[model samples]
Target: MSQSTHLPRTSLAALTLGAIGVVYGDIGTSPLYAFREALAQSAADGISRGEILGVLSLALWALILVVTLKYVLFLSRMDNNGEGGVLSLMALASRATGARWLLVLIFGATGAALFYGDAIITPALSVLSAVEGMRTIPGLEGMGEHTILITTTLVLVGLFALQPRGTASVAGLFGPVCLVWFAALAGLGLWHISRDPGVLAAFNPAWCLDFMESHGVTGLFVLGAVFLTVTGAEALIADMGHFGRQPIQLGWLVLVWPALTLNYLGQGALALHHLAVSEAHHQLMGNEDWFFLMAPDALRAPLVVLATLATIIASQAVITGAFSLSHQAIALGLLPRMTIRQTSAAQVGQIYMPAVNWGVLAGVIALVFGFRSSSSMAAAYGIAVTGTMVVTTCLSFIIAWKYWKWEPVWAALLIAPFLCLDLFFFGANILRVTEGGWVPLLVAAMVGTVIYTWLRGRRVSLERAREQGVAMADLAAALAVRPPVIVEGTAVFLTQDPEVAPSALLHNLKHNKALHRCSILLKVETVNTPWVDPAERVKLEVLDERFTRVRLRYGYMDKVDLPSDLARHPGPQGGGLLSAKGGTSFFVGRSAIRFARKPLLPRWMTVLYMFLHRNAADPTAYFAIPPNRVVELGSQIEL
Candidate 1:
């Protein structure tokens, strides 16, 4: 359960409000273009009352089934130590199964990779759609497409530039601003609904079936567009650690869902009113910007400004989410370590990654220019999100059966409906691949390839190391019998396997022909949970008079501090090694990887793995070791 589950009522309310700002931002802003896009998909046969009601019904049911049921109610409860996300869920399932399952890893990687695709396209789509609302302004109806494009480009650039400085200063405003945004959505929706009560017939699911059966393939195209309504649904489960499940559920049920439903209904009602007016005048009705048009002409400008603010907030949420996900990937060894900067001293999760920020910024800019309009970009949107949803459903089934202790048959039955729904939506989106959906699929492919190569290369490298390495017990016994020239200080050797000799230690002894009077072989292991109890963090074993093996365990989300952890819990025997006359010296092995005579992997994969290894962050900086006190021993290794 989330820590917020035990909070006071006042704090609970605050968290609920926060969830509205961060968790629902993406879905909340869908009103800007979702209705217009869906209706456009089926408008080729001419605008009709039935089409509007059908699209609205599809959007409403999607929110209820996909977002409300699958994410908010079900998956939110399957968290790992109050943390939820693809990687966190992967860890939980792996621990429950008592091993690292390959299928689970692939599912986790696929979800995470698709998330990046969604991350890049969201800021571009949401901002462009919001800014494009200016066309609905009375005098701005003549606004050139170039003007809107330039303004959106500027807004996005400013948003990315502010990332390094951090959002802590302005984060307090996110909830309140979004609150006002949702209120506006409801107010506009209710006013329009009051004008045409006839559109209320959309509440019936019958219209969805009628439209699908009548339109055939065209209905599938509209179904893909309807998916925009639930594009940000993943945030509900992803942000569960930040705000407990209860608060998020309450926020969605009470405010976000109602507001979104009303907004879509309002858009439909407005379209119905236009259709009646056009028919009475003996003229044709065309698809319109019904969301902005719902507001009175006098208030249209302010509405656009508010919509823009809401979309920016949504974009900010996605950017930060990518950073958090990247951090988790590195901790789990799914990605190479990069420089991570904490934007806030009080919040460990408030981090900034320059590489991620710049890379996403570049992608967003390319998308905005390449598509040239939100309607065009919308073609590229749903595939990534739907793909992620499909992966999430599969992982949920494993968690239900293995981790929740449900019978396999029961689990299959429970998940089958949701899985089918996800696949149905995925099939709908697949129809748009040639219409720009290939963009995200290409991005996912590149990311998935990198993750696969890194994992395979690491496994092969570890196997090779173990083959050539001596056992720690043999080394300790040999050193005890033939003592080297004794040094005065203590030395710490870091390795992945504590049972084998660290390459750095052997190299140091071979070159210097001497050993530290007190030597510690240390290994750091990242566990499956989000936190480790301090008492259980360090385990010590004495191998001989001069050698002691130390193991430090950390959760995937925990911050690593080797020097501080060692100082807090010195080894046995009155801490003789740590309390040596000279301060401790840290030694790290630096491998120079190259292709083997008969490589385990293809040539291209070995090249990619070598590139990743060379560029990974330095161990001294990653582990928080003092730079001046660190020694790097280099060795050549074959893949």
Candidate 2:
């Protein structure tokens, strides 16, 4: 399972298609509401031709600078081995900076937490916007209008429920479906682009600068809406572990970016043409209800369905990413262990976490019912995505200077403009904190607290372990003098630290008064890098040729399978496989952690840690050990 970092042999086309399906989902759906929201935000000035052109110019530049240059061309190259994402990127940067830059580490973790906040909002906003196209359709206008929420909820229910079954088979459909979606966007945009070619002039930076000069501070605030254009850019980095770098870049540059630009420009052209027709109707026309106006009347219903599918796919991307991130968090010891299900044998990236699935579903349902409209949810969306984007850019600067060996001045020069853009959007979004922007910020704060607390709690647990536990060397020496009765079968004792005697091992010897003929003291370690080579994964030291101290090193991105990994090694003195079906037994050490009377941590933190520990997934299931052959021994530990 530690070998999960190894890219499975895949064709170029297959990888490209897969990347388009997953990596582009979020950005692909942005055209539905991002432009609409930006227009709505700036409609106070009556949606003039200059404002339409300026907004489109800002959006086009955002795609080029932020998603195109910043993410695809730059950050994609900064992957930790083949893995990318907030946490994995943090792991890589931390290794380069060592542990001294604690602030950078916290920023990285906070970015990951903020992503979950965005994750919760995407489905509700996307589906709501897509389904609201119902109001645009000719006969369907206000007919069964209340059913929109019920329909969106049902669709969400189906999406989350399908997680346990995996996405491999249907994943093929995703590529084709998205291919059609992007094509529709391009075709639709082209239809309008040809009508009013003057909107094509929005590509000129002069229009952007002129618009900014005229609208100063309010223009800066409108960037919060413009920031939505590149929200899915981070996904291109985060999902790198799933489809690798080339395919993602290939999909983005060749198809996704161009299609999105055309669609946005086309929307602008359509709006400008409408404004040209009558300035008095501009304010009424420039609204969240206007995106569907880009499409012709007859195609509106079909486009609605396509948009809904695209949004669902977009939600899938975020949900799948959350699962992957949560899995990585547990592997790296930032979170309590949660059950991870390998949903597909063919693709290692296709995994499901039920707890995450349900938690996200609950949040999505709440957001849908609470906000009730995409127009309202838009206020809550930009803050978390922009905040995470800001942190990622900051972290990338460190990676460039420290890891990539870029010169200090050169690194700062490269990242400075992008950082400024990020900060501007972040600051703009902050102004809306009272107007629903606080939702994601609140979610981010709570999640960040949990991540930091869990990390701190683990440190305390390890310190307590090192202090009270006996050394394996001393135990082996004592055993050499007076050995316990040796039984027939092999026993693999899972320990927190291989150097210290495991509580389960101590319990087994104390109560049973016997030891297996071949005993292995095993500890699985999470390293700073993204992968540990399988050949170098296991470290075995024979303690008197009968008791072996085994340490298995894995990266935060690695999949852990105790039974499968142990099967590849010998029991003692290279005799035979360590686990032999029913002949083997796996011993796990668990602690009933409680708050100490005089606590090193705050009482709130201690209680939180204890609650997480109590609800964490069992070691046997998480490590992929056969439950039938496992024994768990619990000992009380007051934190």
Q: After superposition, how far is residue 394 of candidate 2 from its true place, in Å?
A: 2.1
| lDDT, residue 421, model 1 | 92
The model with the greatest TM-score is 1
Q: In model 1, how many backbone clashes occur?
A: 0
Please provide, for model 2 over 1-639, each residue's C-alpha lDDT reduced to its tens digit, 9 standing for 90 to 100.
111334455765788888898889998999989888887777874777788888899999999988898898988888887788888788888888886799777877888889889989998889888988888999888656468889889999999999999988788889889999999999889989999999899999888898888987778767778888888788988888777888888899899988998899889888877786665543444454656888889889899999999999999989999998888888877788988899999887789998999998999999998888887888899999999888898889998999989998999998999999888889988877887899998888988999988989888987887788899899988987898988888888988778888888899999999988778888888987777888788888888755888888888877787777777866555545565333889898888887788777888998899888889998888888888989988887777
Q: Candidate 2 clashing pairs? A: none
What residue runs in model 1 are displaced by over 4 Å at the alpha carbon?
1-6
TM-score quality measure for candidate 2: 0.94
Models 1 onward score TM values of 0.98, 0.94
Model 2: ten consecutive residues of lowest lDDT: 1-10
Best by lDDT: 1
Q: What is the lDDT of candidate 1?
A: 0.91
